[model samples]
Target: MSDTLTPPMQSADCWTRREIWQQPQTLNETQRLLRDNQGEIERFLRPLMEKTNLRIVLTGAGTSAFIGECLAPWLSRETGRRVEAVATTDIVSAPDLYCEGDTPTLLVSFGRSGNSPESIAAADIAAAKISDLHHLVITCNPDGALARDPGTHSHVVVLPKATHDHGFAMTSSFSAMMLAALSILSGVAALETRIDAICQAVSDILHNADTAMADLAQRNFSRVVYLGSGVFEGLARESALKLLELTDGGIVTAFDTPMGFRHGPKTFVTTETLVMVYVSNDPYTARYDRDLIAELRADNIAAGIVTLSAKAEADDTIAVRNLGGACDADLLFPYIVPAQLFALHASLARGMTPDTPNATGTVNRVVQGVHIHPLNP
Candidate 1:
């Protein structure tokens, strides 16, 4: 696996590798697609934004759910609106936990395939429960239920077809949907320029860092812990899931915020565990992140520690360059690239198929075995 850092084009596990490599390019396409539809999207969102006592809920399942987690905080700050991330799984099961009947709500749905039962159920449930519900469906599949359903007060942004990932795990799909949400909600100026910088930074990492990440995957560590702050906390969660999914649960994984990890979660660290800290660019948040790294070094409990940051000082750190002093929200894209690559390498290193690690058919690309119950009338 280390010898073959970039999997062969025709290899069994090529889909994952190819998709991961193609993200920098697809992300640019997503930016262009969003720019092309900026006016329509802004029009669709304006009325919802104008509503008094408005609330925004970002909902999705699995990786899609993590996208909301990543964006909610940033969007909240950018739009100065109440924003929350709720998983479709949670909403489908307990709609009242996150949604309200009277609040003018904007339910932003993030889905790769858009066909997931919970994704559809969440949008339907929000419409049925919230009297002033508006939906902004961001998905890769144009034909998916969320996109095709003729629901009132809904707008769909379908990403390029390439994002409808062929592999069992989502690579391009997740990042594209995330970038779409960012472009629509945040109104980051010169987004294409930022995206180009992000692409260059990630391309460098993909080319230069794969061997190191692959070698790290070959280490005998049985447990991996990913830590970050704010948006990167969601990235940490996504990273942990990627590793867990790719390894077919062969390796145990955990994720938490830098501060949160100190409270009992730190006990998970042992000599056989590897810790990856996503250091924040925000000076205030980076303090806590750096403190945790220092504490971890002092404890020396983990087998190895790696820090990913724009401002890295040590050999063990992976520096993401040319962010052009972008905010944490913008930095999220480049930060997660290494995690994806590590998962691919780890999957191959474990002699598991990256394209389909779930050999037993217990899990699926689109989840199975869920029976969506009808909401009571």
Candidate 2:
């Protein structure tokens, strides 16, 4: 198949070559793979959650890090375990601060290559310092070092090879890992049913994503703010980064929890800005999400306001109303899909390469630079 015809998740088209026209099929493959693997994954993840005093740590770099952020809160609430999404960069640089405490840690690492220096370093640090550390490496690359390690209580769930995106930016790989992590932690016995629904929604969005984002890209917004609460907040951060990266800084993007935005970040929204919120499925969190949408609408602070949710409610007209309804954490998959589409379209609109959006050549599929210094303690 031609690069454009291949699913964005598995395509070899560098970011520079992809078009807004090709994301739906890519998304469909993502849903199919996850659904097919649901049973096997559930069998493995359920027992892990049952362990007493489990402390789950989700870590990754860049887009990979955002996956943990999107999953942390939902998993914490669902499993009632202590879960935090830590950036590998943060954990590696300050291992003493993050890994020093006494807790049996389930260290979940998300990486596309599974070979980033910090990802490898963070794994080493956890194994060395934490007494009861278990590892779940969710990555696309089977040959990467993170997937090959056998010394620790580690299980590597390599996503379907199709998920390994060839674009300089992460698209399918990001969603696949996020879905895998959610399945591992959701504790649902009938996970196949839920997976089916989620996958259907993803397919629907990808079918329409290119056209939708191409239109949105026409707006002259210069500042973008993404909002969500709980698990979605981390998704907001990832969405913001995708927009920034894909647009190559053509737009300045920011992210915050819906309530947290009012504290200080609201100042960034002006007539030229776009404010997007990922609404929560739970009542309390949704109320907060809705209230913020109302506040932003009342203020008219930005040129446009968009809301994304599984179910269509009052906020639908003001926002995009993307999916029907899934677990709150699963929304991360759909939420990030739009951002990825938006970024690709926006890059094309700006005459920039979607595959290698960073024209200065700083980032890559396997990020370069930074010597993985040998651990010294």
Task: Give the alpha-carbon lDDT of every model.
Answer: 0.86, 0.74
TM-score of each: 0.95, 0.87
lDDT of 1 by residue, 1-377 (tens): 12113433544447888888877778878888888888888889877777657899998999999999999998898788999999999999988887799989889998888889898888888888989988889999988888899289889999988888988888889998999998888763457657777767767777767778889988968999999999999999999999999999999999999999999999999999999999888888989999999999999788999888887766546888776377888788878888898898889888888989998999999888899999877
Per-candidate clash tally: 0, 8
**How do the residues 73-146 of candidate 2 rate in per-residue lDDT, one tens digit apiece?**
77788779999989999888888889955788889999888888889989988888898888888888888888
The CA-based lDDT of model 2 is what? 0.74
Which 10 successive residues of model 1 have the least lDDT summed?
1-10
Clashing pairs in 1: none
Q: For model 2, what is the alpha-carbon lDDT of residue 181?
A: 75
Q: Please list the residue runs of candidate 2 whose C-alpha ends up more than 4 Å from where it truly belongs after superposition.
A: 1-48, 314-325, 373-376
Q: Best by lDDT, which number?
A: 1
